[model samples]
Structure formats: C-alpha cells, structure tokens
Target: DLSEILSLHDFEAVARHTMNRRGWNYYSSGADDEITMRENNTAYQRIWFRPRILRDVTKVDFSTEILGHKSSMPVYITATALGKLGHPEGEVVLTRAAHEHGIIQMIPTLASCGFDEMVDAAAPGQVQFLQLYVNADKSRTKKIIEHAGKRGVKALFITVDAPQLGRREKDMRTKFEGNASSHQTKGGDKVQRDAGAARAISSFIDPSLSWKDIPFLKECAGDMKIILKGVQSWEDAVLAAERGCDGVVLSNHGGRQLDTAPAGITILPEVVAALNQRGLLVPPGKPRFEIMVDGGVRRATDVLKAVALGATAVGVGRPFLYSMSTYGFEGVCHMLQILKDEFEMNMRLIGAPTLTDVVPSMVDISALKVPTVGNTMFGVNYETMYPAGV
Candidate 1:
C-alpha cells in the first residue's frame, strides 16, 4: 500500500480512508474556521525557488544538527498528543521510527503513554526533546523537568502559547458525545463529555505561565537546552533569547491554536531580522540562537524554504502520523525515507550541497504576503494534485 504513496498527500488520503472517524477529525481539524490551517500549506505556494545549476552537487547531503545532535535531515517529529488515538503502539512507534531515521522526536506531555514509557522505549543515545505544558502545580512541573534531565532529554521546548486551548470545531464535533474519556477522568475527576479530546486532557495547562518561570524551568532542566515552542511574532522571538532561552520555535501549534495567526513561514524573515538587529540572533560569545518553524510543511521544498529564510530546522507532525496510522512503524519509516530522498534531490536541484548552503537567496518571498481564500472543505480530505510529468 505504501508503494502507492508517492507523496505526503497520499499518506493523508490513505489514513483518512482507514483511521477512525473520531481520531481523524481530532487530528485533521484546526481552530475556528481553520483559515490559518489552510494558509499554512498555501503560503509555501507563494514562494518559488531560484535553483542554481552547474555546481558540484553530486553528493547532496541532508544531514543537519539540532542543539548539537546529528539529524539526518532538517526535520524532526514535532510533538502531537494522544498517539493511542491513532495506533495501538502509541507514541513509542514514533520513538522507534525517529531513531531508525536518525532524527529527533519531541515527546508531548499529553501523550497516551506515560513520559517514562516513551523515554524508556528509546534506543540508547537517541535524541529526544520534551514539549511541556506548564501545570498549575509548580512542584509537579519542577519534578517533571527534573526527571526529564535525569532521563537525558536533549532539550525542553516549553510551550508559550495556548493560555487557553483553541476551540477546534472538528474535534469538538466528535466531543466523545455522551461518553467520558476514561483517560482524562482518572481519580474520580468529573467527566467532561462535551469537551473534545484536547480540552478533556489538557484542562490543566497553566494560563499564567509567564516569562518569570523561564529561570525556574532552566534551573530545573539543569543542562538541557530550554526553547520556547509557540512563538509567532518577532518581538516574542527576540524576548525568548533575551530571557535566557536557547531558541524559539515559530509555530502556531499546527494551526490548532489561534486561527488566522500568521503561518510560521511567512513570519520567519521578520523574526530573523529582529533577532539579528538586536545582535541576539547569535550574540557574541553566546550559544547560537536557533529559530525553528513548523506547520504547513509538506514537501522537502517547504523545509528548504524555511532553511533559506533562517530556520535551523522544521518540525513535521501530521504527515508522519498519517503514515503511521496508515502503515504502522514501517509506514513511518517509509515516510521519513521519502523525506530524506526529497531533501537530497531538492538540495541538488536548488544547488545546495548541504543545509548551510540553503541560504536566504535560494527563495523569493515577494509573493508570500499575497493571499487568497483556501477551500475549507479540503481539510477533511486531501485533494491529490498532479504535475505535468505525472
């Protein structure tokens, strides 16, 4: 079946046809009206590549480093919650797949499997990052970070956005209807049948998680790199660096939060400029601040575009889930291999032998600001497109 999957869209199509209705809607839906979700993907269409030729690109290497760890490509498995919704093996399937592909996986706080289970399942020395949702209980939060350090997570990507989880209508529509999610209602907590999967599980994310807590988190994390994960504006991006964090991921939570927030790619230029202007981008004698982008990334072309604009790497979640939900661990590995192949071929086509060569000049963002209405109906299903050669 994977042989029939030539593109990421194919994975989505197959997954949609195979995955449970509740899980599909929860995974595919975005925030209200889903404008930002569609725009995330469409934004890439606005930028065209200015490929170079006649260079010694015979060996287009895609290997890149994240927080000093080697990654086979400028791609990592961004954290997504409740992996059991899609597969029996849960998030550990992703853990194994990430190791096999030599990429990083950001473990989520809301994963179906306990944090230790995911961590314990990792192959030795496999790099994993933890995405945290600060709990109202400060002591518990401290303990979580401390345990992450002891377990050897490479980084802590503390989520700074989502003071309140967005109203994901598609996920809400399923709403467990009349049934309470047993997972979220442990210890005799009140059943919340009306709340969607996210709200049911994530009701405890501290809305008061301010910059003041960054120091506490850093101290708790010990030597682990502390990166803020939901930064959107250039000001916040700069503030994260000045606040003593190592980096910021310019993500809008895969368009799951804050509908109509600018897609992460469209804002990468300004974030870079803002940080560079402050001399904070890579301040003298300080660790080089990394900027990462996620959301609306489908093609390796999209990944290279972000790299060209200034992102050190990009986080991809849904497509990998789609592949996993459709084809299991093998499917996830195949999807990564597909990306690896795309990175190599696209790099040569664009005349970049390596990620560092994927500079700002390789892409034209002049059309990036231009926008048009995207079809919302397409969210539930992927409409496969064909090129002239196809």
Candidate 2:
C-alpha cells in the first residue's frame, strides 16, 4: 500500500484518512478564509516552463548546498510543529529519514518530542537546523539558543511571522474534541487543550519580538547562521540582510498567520532583486547570505522553478508530515525517493544537467502577477473530504 503512494499529494490523501480528525484539521487548515493557503499552490500553476531541447542530459545532478551544508537535493524538510499529531515518534521519524537521504531537517521549537530527544535520535554526523519561536522570557530564549548551539545545530531559523496565532477555524471547531491519548505528555496532561493546538502551544511567543532583538539573538546564536523565517516584504528582507542576519526564508508561516499573505514563491523575485540591488545577494564563492522559500511545494518541478528564480533552496513542510502520518518512516523515505526520481526526470527534460544549469531563462513567470480566478479544485476536494456539518 505504501509503494502505491507515488506522489506527495497521494501522501496527503492517505494522511487525511489515517490521521485523527482533530490532528488532520490542525495540520491542514490555514487562517480564516484560507485564501492565501489556496493561492500558495495555484500561484505555481501561473508560472509556465520553457524547456530546452538538444542538450545532452545523460547524467543530471540534483545535489546542492544549503547554509553551507551539503544536501543531496535543493530541497530540505522545513519545520512543522507538534509532529506527534501525525506520528508517535514525532520529529525523530523525520530526523532519521532526512539523515538517511543526506538532506537537512529543521527541528521545530514546539515539537512533540523535546529538542534534545530529536537530536539524539538523528544519525551520527547528520545535519540539523533549529527553528526558534522566541519565548517571552529573554533568558529562556537565550538558554534554548545556547543549548542548540552546543548540540551541533548548523543554523538557527528565528520564526518572525507568528507573534500571535491566527484564527484557524477548522482547528477552532475541533477544540472541544477529546484528546487522543497517544499525543499526551509525561504528566498525563494533554499537549493541547481548549484553545486548539496552535494557540495553546504558542502562548510563550513574545509579541514584542522586534528588530532590536536581532543583535541579542546573534549574540546568543554564536556563529550559527541566523535566518529570519516568515519574511514577506522586500523591505523586511532588505532589513534582515542589512541587520547582519545570514538569510531570510520567504514564507507566510504556511499561510497559518495573516490570511492574505503572498505565497513564498510569488515574492521570491522581489526579495532576490532587493537583495541584489543592495549587493547583498551573495557573490560566487563567498560564505554569503542565502534566500529560501517554503509553501505549497508539492512536486520536484516546484523545487526546480524556485531555483530558476534565484532561491538557494526550497523548504517542504506538510508533505513529509503527511507522509509520516500515513506510513511512518517508510512513508518519509518513499516520499524523498519519489522526489528524487521526479527531480532527475524533470531536470533532464528542462535541459539542465546540473542545479546551476537551472537558470531564469528556463521558466516563463510573466502571468504570475495577473489577477485571474484561481483553480478551486482543492476547495471542492476538501469539502468533499469533510462535508459540511459532518
């Protein structure tokens, strides 16, 4: 049954059936209206490809570096919280899978398993990055950063989008539902309570997180690359670069915050352009600042498209979670293998013998900004999957 799951979307279909109702809603639903969530996928459709022919593509390479770490592909598993909602092993499942495949995994601050536990589960010498949700207490935040630094975390991604949790209506509706005992904590306490998983777990995120704290975080991080996650605007991206931040992930918190925020891929050009205009887009051979994107990356073609637009790499979130939920560690490995196959085939078709060969000329994104009706297939399918009033 797991072998039949050939695509990332297939993993979602299985996860929808296998995961409990509350967990599914929490992982799948975005903020109110869910417009941004839908757009994240549809926007990719707007960018058409211009495949080249007559190029010898006997062997193609998908290997690349992210934040100075060697990865087998240009994609890395992005951070998603409360991994136990999908699997009992929590983020450790992803840790093992990513290590086996020679890819990086970003450990979530609010993981179901503790930070140290997840790192301990990793294969020896496996590269891991830490995603930080700044705590209201400065000392608490400092301690976490220092501990992660000691644990051999290669980078520190500071989440900047969620000072306050968004109103995810699906999760809100599921709040009164009974907790699944498997997801409970050591003290027999439910990891989530009445406020729904997002709100309940994010209470410690400091609302006052601002530019002034960047220098303090740099001091705490101590040589680990500090990248700002959830950066949307070109202005903010520019500021992140100017402030000595090592990189910026152009994300909207997977549309979980700010319902109408633009898709990460949609804003990639502007961010790259701004960085270039300021001479901050890292020059060749320098340990330079990186640009990354995460949201609605369902295929290897999506990864290729982002690279063409000048991203150092792309981050994938829900797909791996759904994969793990549906088939555990095997599902995760299979999903990566599927992506690898797709990347190879697509890269050859696009006439790119290597990742660096994937240039801006290979894609046509002129229709990206035009306001047209988006495909409502996801909405229709979602409604069919969870019909109104149950």
Candidate 3:
C-alpha cells in the first residue's frame, strides 16, 4: 500500500500532513528566522553545474572510502537524535536501511534507543560512526566512548556547533520542543523523567575543548578514527589536523547554528586550499585526512560538486529524516539508491572515471563571484547575501 505513496518530494508533503503540527514544526523548523537554513539550499542553486559529455557512460562507479571505511557511495547519513518519533524501530530502521545501501550511518549519542542495540542491529562491518554531543557529565561521555569502542563503531564525530540548541522560532512559536531528558523507549536511564516540558537543553559540550582536548579524545577513542564536525574556517581545519583529528565535517549544523555563518560549501574550498598547502590532506602512506561536508545537499549534482571541491565525502541531514517521516525504512533506502544512481550519472556526465577525477577544473568557479562595497573588497557571506570581512 505504501509503495505507491513513494517519491522524495512526497515524503516531506506526507510527513507534514501525517505528523502533528507541533512535531512537524520541531523537525522542520530551523534556528532564528531560519535565514541560514534558507540560504543553505539557495546557495546550491546559485552554483550551476557544467556537465561534460562524450565519455563511456555505460559503466560508472560510486563506491568510495572515508577514513579507511568503504561505502557504496560517498554519502553518509548525518546523525540526528530521536528517530523513534518517526517510527517504532527508530535508529534500527535507519541503520538497517543504511546498511542495505552500504553507506555510513552516523548514530547520535542522544539517540532514543541504547547504543548497544543500534550497533547490534547493524549488519556486521556496515560502517557506523558514533556522534557525541559532549554531555556535561565527562564520566558519562567517557562511558559512551568506551561503549562505542566495544561496539566496533568505526569513527567518532564530535559535533561542536550545538553547545546549546539553536533558537528555532517556529518550534518556539508552536511550543513544540525536543527534550533531552525524555525517553521514547522503556527501561533506559538515558531518558529524562518528564517529556512535556519546554526549555533549552545543553549538550554538555566542553567550551574548554581546545587543541588541548584532541589528545585526550584520541586516548578515549582507542584507535577509532575521530572527526570534528561543525568546522567552518581554514584556521579550524588546519588546527584540527594539528590536534590529530582524522577529518573535519565542514558544516554549520545545517545552518541551525550560527544563523550568519557562511554556507558549508562556501568555506569548503578554503579548507581544501589550506589542506593542500600543508600536505595535511594525506597521511603518512594513506590518503589525506578527509574533508567532508554537509548542508543543503538535495541533489546528486550537489554531491558531485562537494567531491569536486575536495570533500572526500558528504553528509545528508534533514532530507533523509524527511524521507523517513514519509515512508519509513523503505523510503530511506530508496532515497539512498536514487542518490547513488544520480551521483554515478553525474560522475559520468562530468567525465570523472573515479571520485579523484572530480577536480576543481570539473567545477566552473567563474560562475562564482565576490561582492564589493564601493572601493572596498569583501568576502561574500552567502548566508546574508551580502559582503562581510573586507
């Protein structure tokens, strides 16, 4: 019955209609006026694709590796908390679908179900990265890292953007909020006793996280690759390397954090340029530390664009959840399949035999321009659609 209801766009429409307005608002709404959220997609539109032809398009490969883990495609399922809100299986459904597609699924630390259950549900060696929110309880954070290590999670993504949740006006107006202290399933100490309250919840992110914490994180992670998510500047990218991070997920938390920050794509080139300058991109005998990006990625062309700009891979957020809301596990699986197909088509049309062939030359940056104020030059802040930092 549900197969007939399938379509990527329909997922959003159906989800909006099926879920309570409050729940929908909580999931769909972004921070502040959602200016950055709007810009995340708009900036992608501004960059037009110049597809190349005249290649043998019959065969195309979408498989790639990120930090030593292989994936059928370069897309990773960006972590989001509380999947049970959409379905009973929650992360199990999402991870199972991701495993079926052979892509990475980053499981959130604040996930509704126990981490062990999620790891157990995943197909063995099906690449799952554990995402942590840096809880106020350092001991709890340590226990989480240890738990993940035992689960054979491939990597740890420390999300830094949400020291505290963003100001989602729509959710605020609707009085719909996501509570950290609430439990979706029975018998977990992770859930808060009260789920009905509305208030700001902190991720216990260590504001003290400096270059100093990197070594400690390495110690805690054992040998699991560590990536610092939410990096948006060249300095931070380079520092991440110095601090021994395996990668940097260039993002602004889908523009949910820092409403005025530049789009992740806008700063990606800068990060790549820095990596190339220092030779930090590749490790001793392996590929360089990965530079992955996420935000406003809705199409395969966008995935191609990120790869061309030096992202080893890209992460997809809200849209996957939207698909989940619309059609559950099958919807998410189909979404990935469609993206993989599109990515391969894009690679062939753009004359890329492999992911490495997706070079800067493949992208027409001439279409990219900077803005000015009279005689003063300034960097274009894509979020504000204006000039900043002259």
Candidate 4:
C-alpha cells in the first residue's frame, strides 16, 4: 500500500490516522499560534522559477556534499527529538533509512536509543552528524562531543535556537488532557507540572549558552566540523563564521522554538549576501563555509529552490517522521525514493542538469520584494484543525 503513496503529504495523512493521538499532536503541532510554521512552507510560493530552456538535460545528478560528505541529493535528515513516540523502533529507523538512501542523518542529542546504539547501527563509512543540545554540565557535554568524534561523527551541529522549549499548545493540551491522578488534590501544593513532552524531556538544556562557549565546544569537538544550527539572522551567521565555526544553519528551530520567526529560506539570500560582504563566505583554500537552511521544506522543488539560493543543502524532518511512523523502514525508504524521482524529473524540467546549473538566476525573487509579513501570513483563509466536539 505504501508503494501507492506518491507524496510526503500522503505519508502524513496516513500518520495522522494511524499514529496515537498524543504522537500525532506532538509531531504535527507548532509553537504558539503556528503562524511561523505555516509561513515556513507558504513563503516558498512567493519565489517563482525562471527555468531556462535548451540545456543538455539527459542525465540529472542531484548528488552533492554536505560539509564535504557526499549525499545523494542536497538534502539531509534534520534532527527531530523523541522518535519512539511515533515509531516503536525510534530514531534507529531513520538511521537505517538514511543508509539505504545514501543521505546524511543528523543524530539528535536526545534520542530514545542510546548514542552508541545509533552510531553502531550505521553501515561502515556512513557519515553521521551530531545535533547537540549543550547540557548544563560542561563535562557531560564535552564527553559527548569527544565520544562522537571517536565514533566518526563528521560534524557537530550545535543547536543554538531553543534555549527553552516553546509553547506547543496542541501538544500540551493533549499531553495534559485527562488521566490526572486525584492524589495531587490532597497534596499541599507539591504537584509537578506537565508542560508537554517537549519540556519534560529537555529540562537540562543550558540557557546560558553564549558566544563565549564556542571555543570550548571547538576544543571538545576535536576534528568534527562545528556548525551552529538555528541561526536566524545574517548577524549570527556572520558571527559564527568569524568565530571559527565551519558553517551555520539559518533556521528558527522549524518554527517550534520561536513563533513568527521568518522562514529559513526567505532569509538565505540575505545570509549569503552578508557572509560574502564580510569576505567570510569561504576563506582561501579552506573548505567552503557551508550555509544550510531548514524549515517548511515539503517538496523536492522546495529543496531545489533552497539549492538555487546558496544553501549547500536543506534539512527535512517531519515528512520522514510521518513516513517512518506510518510504515516503518519501507515507508521511509519509499518516501526518499519519491524525493529521488522528483529531484531528477524537476531538475530536467527546470533545465538544470546538475546542481551547478541551479544558480541564483533560476529563481525569480521579485515577489520577495514585499515585506516579509506579506510573504508570510498564509492568511485567515488558512485552515486549522480542531478537536472533535470543539
């Protein structure tokens, strides 16, 4: 039946019906009113393609390197927490799927499976990256970084956006709905609060993580390319490069950390422009200071749009989760195959035989001339889901 699933949304539709209510809400809900979440995808609509004609498009190669690691396409599996919530096998399902597809996977700091377990699951020479949530305890964080280096984690994508978990009310409401033990009513105000799985699982994150800690992290990370993920503005992107970070991911934590944050794709041009302005886009004879983006990427066309704008690659998270949750390994593999098919077909239609041909001119950003508010706000016409009997 999964073979009949044509798009990522099909997988999502299946996930909504089959996964538990808690898992479904947790996986799909965004922070606050979810404006930024919707904006993340819709913003892509503003940029139309200026596809060129008459190019030798016989063979299309979407393969590219991320921080020098070869990937089948300019796409990598971005880290998402609590995989077991949706699938019985948890994050390892994604690990195996990435292997089958030959794409890179960023292992999350908080995975249901042990760190070594996922790393051990990898095929020989399969490159993995670590998405670290710096613990309050520096020694523990250092140990994780060092261990990852020894395990051959090629990069450290230190998440810088979520100092504290955001309010994903849909997840919280369902998380807190019912099943309350009445014993708490007898207590003299010693009851613990349930702020949903997001806060419960992420309590140890150090809010004091500042620019000063980069050098310490670099020292701990050893040879792993240190990339600061969740960079929102051009300023932070520039700072990361200047401070010796190998690259930066312009993200808003997939609109889960900060509501109303601009989609990463919309900001990619400015980030690239600023990085080039400061002469830090790529230093002489050094590995290119990779600028990646994630958030609101749904289609392979969205991936190409990001590629066209200066992103070395794009990170996709939810679609893979939906696939994995619905049908496990085969589901994830099939979803990836769909992307692979789209990449080749779209590449040809757009007259891009290779990623090099996916230059900036291929996209017409004139629609982006309006203010970001206009670009976002998918409008009151934007439909929203509600609980039954609401």
Candidate 5:
C-alpha cells in the first residue's frame, strides 16, 4: 500500500475513504463557507517558478535549521490537534517519524496523548516544539508552559487567531446526526455537551488573549523562545517583533478560523517587507526573529516558493496527518521520504544547490493577489460533499 502512494494528494484521497466520516470532516472542514480553505491551496497556482539551468548538479543539500534547531529540510511538521482521531498511536507516531527523518514536530496542546507521554516517545536528542493554546485559567496555562520548558521543548508557538473556534458545518452536521464524541476531563468526567471536536475541545482556551499577554507568556515560558502562530497581517507581524517574540507564523490557522482570511503565502511578501522595513529580519546565520508560513502546502515546490519569498521555513500540517491516518508510522515515514526526494530533484532543477540559493529571484509571484472571490482548485473540494440530502 505504501508503494502505491505517490503524491501528498494521494494520501488525502485514501484517508477520506478509510477514515470515519466524523474524523475526516474534523480534519478537512474549514470555517463558514470554506472559501479560505479552498483558496489556501489554489493561491499557489498564481505563483510560478523561474528556474535556472546550466548549473553544476553534481550534488545538492536540503538540510537547514529551524528556530535554532537543525533540520533535514526547509519544512517542519506543523501542529495539528487530536492525532488519536486519525491513528491509535496519536502524536507519538509523529514524534517517532520526525526523529527518524531528522526534522522537527510541533506538538499540539490538545494532542490526544499527554505532553509528557509524547516527549517520552521521542528518541533521545530529537528536537520538538510545543504549540500552546492558552487556558482561561492563567495559573493552569503558566504551569503548562513551565512544564513544556522543563520537558525540553525548543520553542512555544502561542496560537493567536482562535479566541474562539470557527463553525465547521460538516462537523456540526455530524454532531446533529448524534455521532460526535463528547469532550472529557482528565478524571473521565464529561466537561460539556458535544458540538463537534473543535468547539468542544477548545472551550477552555482564553478569549481575552492580547498583545499585553505576550510578556506574561514569555515570563511564564522562562528561557524558551516565544513565537506567535496565527498572525495574518503586516501590522501584527511588526508588533510581534516589537514585543520581542523570536518569530511569527503568518497563518490563518490553516484557513480554518476565518473564512475570508488571505492565504499565508500570499501575505508573506508584505509581512517580510514590513519586518525588513522595521529592521527586524534576522541577519544571515543568526538565531534571531524569523518569519514562517503555513496553510495549503502540499508539495516540495510549495516549500521552495515560500523560501523564495523570504520565509525562514514552511510548516506542513494536513498531508502528514493524512499519511498517518492511512498507513500509520510507515505512511508518515514514506511521506517524508517523498518530500525529501522532491526537494532534492526540485533543488537541482531550480539551480539552487543550497538553501541560501533559493532566494526571491527564483520565483515569479507577480500575479498573486488577495482573492476577492473563492477560487476552488486542487485538494479537498468541499462543493461535492453535500448533494441535496434533504
């Protein structure tokens, strides 16, 4: 079965058929009309590569560092919640696979497996980061952050977009069918009625999170690096740098939170320009503030395009989860291998032998504009899902 899979899209197609409808919808559905979700992937179509030829293609290296940690490529496994919904082993599968591949994994706060357990599953010296969903209870949030620091998490990615979870209609419909599972507390007590996974699980997240809270989170996190994960504008990116965050992920929470938000890649140029204008771009070979992007990255070329636009690196979420859902740890391993292969070939073709060679000049993004209307193309077409079922 692993041999049969070729592209990241293939994993998604197989996962759709193999996973339960509840789980698949939870992973795939975006907010409101799902326009932003579709745009996240299709936005890549507007950017084209300006590859070079006649370069020495004897060897190429894809290895790079992320947030002061070395990685085998210019991508990391971005945070995704409730991995147990996809596989029995949950986030541990990611921990193991990331270790094997020499990359980093951003462990989610709402992981099915507890934080310590997931850390325990990682191989010794394996680098990992923690994605924090700040709790309404400040003391509880502080304890969790301090715990992650003690547990050797390399960084803290505080999610800033989701003050509240978005309404994913598919998951809501699944709940209305009485098939959704209830959220439970650590003592096996039911916390609330099920309203699909996102809302039910995210009820504990603090709604009043703001810029003023950054210093408090930094203080709570001790010496670990602090980065905001859901920023969508140049203004916030500048403020994040001003607030002394180590990095900012220009994301719309995978287009799952706001339906009309710009794709992460589309806004990256402006964010980079703003940061540069403020003298915030990190000088080469320094471990300072970085800019990262995520959302609708399905290929090595997508990663390459982001790097060309001044992103330190790219974050990939859904494709790896789909791989895990389809074939467990082996599938994850295979998926990473596929990406590694693609990066090598693409790098050779693009005439960028090193990560530094993949610069702004390598891609043409002149046609990239903020979408005024939803344009549906490649990956997870939501239109075909409902067909007059009433």
Candidate 6:
C-alpha cells in the first residue's frame, strides 16, 4: 500500500532518496551554521508541557480565528513554491486536500499552476490565502494582488522575509534547478521555462521599496486583509500594524532568508509580547494585529506551543512538502489530519479544551534569555526593544 509505503517517518527517509540531492538540501538548509534552525527545535524541546488530568475533553474544539477568518484549525499549510514538482497535479491536488481536511493553505506566488485554477479545484471559498513576494516589477506585484482580489482570495499574505534570497549552501553545491525570481505564484509575469527543466534566475528584491511603499500596497490590496509574512522583530510588527496591515506572520522565512537570524519560534515571544504591550506605540483603536509564526514546527504539540506563545496561527512547511512528495494529495490530507488530530489530542491532554484556554504563560520561556524592555537589559526603552517601535 502506497499509504503504508510512506508514513510520516518514511516521508523523511524517502525524501532523502527521491529528491534531487541538492534540492532536498536547499529546502532543508538553514543559514550560515544552521544554529538558529537547530535552536528552533531545541528551544521547544526545553519547554515541558504540564498536562492536567480528568478534564472534560470529550468535546475538543480546535477552531480559531486568524485575521477574523475562522479556521477549523489554527495550524495551516505554509506557502511553498513549485508544487508541480512535488506531484503531477501539484497545487490542485494540495488545495483539494486542504479543503477536504478543513485546514488553511497559504498558496505561494511562485506556484507552478495559476491561482484561479487552484481556487476552482479546492472547495469554493476555502480558507486559502495567497502569499505574495513583491517582484522587482511593481506593476507585477499590483497586478497579482488585484487578480487575487477578483478571484475571491480571502487574504493577502505579503512575504517580506525574502527581500533577498539567503545563500542556500545545499542548492549552491548541487546547482539546484529553479529560478527564485519566477517562482512567485500570485504575480502576472509568466514563468518562461525550457520544457521540463527549471529556469535559472536572480534575486527579485526591489531595493527601491521604502516604508512609504506600504501605503501604496495598502491601497492596491484594498479590501483584502493584509498579512506581513516575514516580520521577526517587534518594531517591524508595530510598523506593519501602524501601516494598516491586518497581521504580521512572525517568521524567519523558514530559516531560508538569513543564515544567522533567530528562528521563528525563538523570536516568537519578543514579537508577541511587544505587540500585546499597551502603549502609545500603536494606534488607539487599532485591534491588536494578528501574530502568526512558522519555522521548524515538526509536530502537533509544536503547533500548540506556538499558539500558547501568543501566535494566533502557525504554519507548517517541510512536513506538508514531505507528504506531497511521498503520497500526493492523499498523503498531504493524511499528514494534515495527523497534525490536527495530534493537536486536539495534546490540547486535551494539556487540559486546554479550547484554543482560548492556552495563554502566554502556558509555556515557561523564562529559562531562555528572551530580552524584555521594562527590565532594561540595555538603556533602550521598551519600545526600542522592537525594531519598529511597538
């Protein structure tokens, strides 16, 4: 049975064999020494969950709201490029799987297939958000956002972490085939290719983009809720909120952006705590911006840990890719099921019947030296602890 052929564990084992060695390395590679990527998992390992016994957990509810949209589960699929390479049907199959499972999928701008096609394949109005990587061409970026809006896409997830691609040593060594520039899924530019092979390309970062460019993006996005996907600092989080962005996805581009930066989970608290702090920093009536994080999240309990750490939502990247590569849509659906099931099971075991029951103190991060401003580790003000004055 193919299903039995590739259990979640088997996916990892098989992935090492089936993928282009360099490609696998690129997807798995962390920046510089990969210390942060290692830390993303180790930090979580350090936290021990204290499960409460004899709680009424027969009726477990895992549903939660992200940017006001109800998700059956707080965990969602991370935006990944080139679904076509993963399976014959690609995003079409993945979207159907996500729809079937009542989970969210973040469709990348660089998806091999068109967004409208994926939208039609999935359940109508499924909770799939479009992730945008603003291309070097501003017009291309605007056109993509406008198209997504017309297609009834629920949210606009702007990926700001990858302004410049990180030096992926694995891909570099193997000469992995693909163009980062054309990989984006939402934009209008057609990804020209030579038949079956991936194309070679260069960096897509628009160095010209300034803080002022955000208002233009806000105007372009119009009614589509905006989520900045690569925010790791409190300052950037606050900036996103002040600039009218509805949410900030606290991520380090899945450890794919910079090699030396902190892992998403490692930096989750700083972003969440800063955003939650009451101050003149944010607009008075501005509903606190959503904090969603992803990177090195390997288990359902990891999702629970992130939610407890103040993340409204958490993204799963490589795990879904592993499923897709190993068993196609059926595998992807099954993997999501396992994660959601595990999440609910763990939530009950931990005595948190509902998502709201999980709070900041759910996991003690004090052992970790997470810098706080009120304490003044430095002379910097509390707001300065964040990069953008939260």
Candidate 5 positional error at 332, Å: 0.4
The alpha-carbon lDDT assigned to residue 374 of candidate 6 equals: 59
Which stretches of candidate 6 lie above 4 Å from their native place? Answer: 1-10, 176-202, 279-286, 370-390
Candidate 1, 125: how far from true, in Å?
Answer: 0.7
**Candidate 4 runs further than 4 Å off:** 176-193, 372-390
Clashing pairs in 5: none
Total clashing pairs for each candidate: 0, 0, 3, 0, 0, 9
Q: On residues 264-287, what C-alpha lDDT tens digit does candidate 6 reach at each position? A: 776666666566564523447866
TM of each candidate vs. truth = 0.92, 0.91, 0.87, 0.91, 0.91, 0.85
Segments in model 2 whose C-alpha atoms lie over 4 Å from true places: 176-192, 283-286, 371-390
Best by TM-score: 1
Q: Candidate 6: lDDT of 138? A: 84
In model 5, where is the ten-residue run with the lowest total lDDT?
378-387
**If the candidates were sorted by their lDDT against the true structure, best first, what order would they fall in?**
2, 1, 4, 5, 3, 6
Q: Please give the CA lDDT of all the candidate structures.
A: 0.84, 0.85, 0.73, 0.84, 0.83, 0.70
Q: After TM-score superposition, what is the CA distance of residue 218 in candidate 1 from its true location, in Å?
A: 1.5
Task: Compute the lDDT for candidate 4.
Answer: 0.84
Q: Answer with 1 or 6, whichever has the higher TM-score.
A: 1
215: Cα error in model 1, Å: 1.4
Can you write out model 2's per-residue Cα lDDT over 1-390, one digit (the tens) per residue? 987887999999988888998789989989999999988888899888889999999999999999999999999989898788889888899999999899999988878888888889988899999998887778878988999999999999999999888989888777734333211122333345686777666555679999999999999999899999999888999999899999999999888899989898887877776677678887556567799999999999999999988888999999988998889999999999999999999999999999999987677776776644783312212122222422
Model 5, position 271, has a per-residue lDDT of: 78
- Output the better candidate (4/6) by lDDT: 4
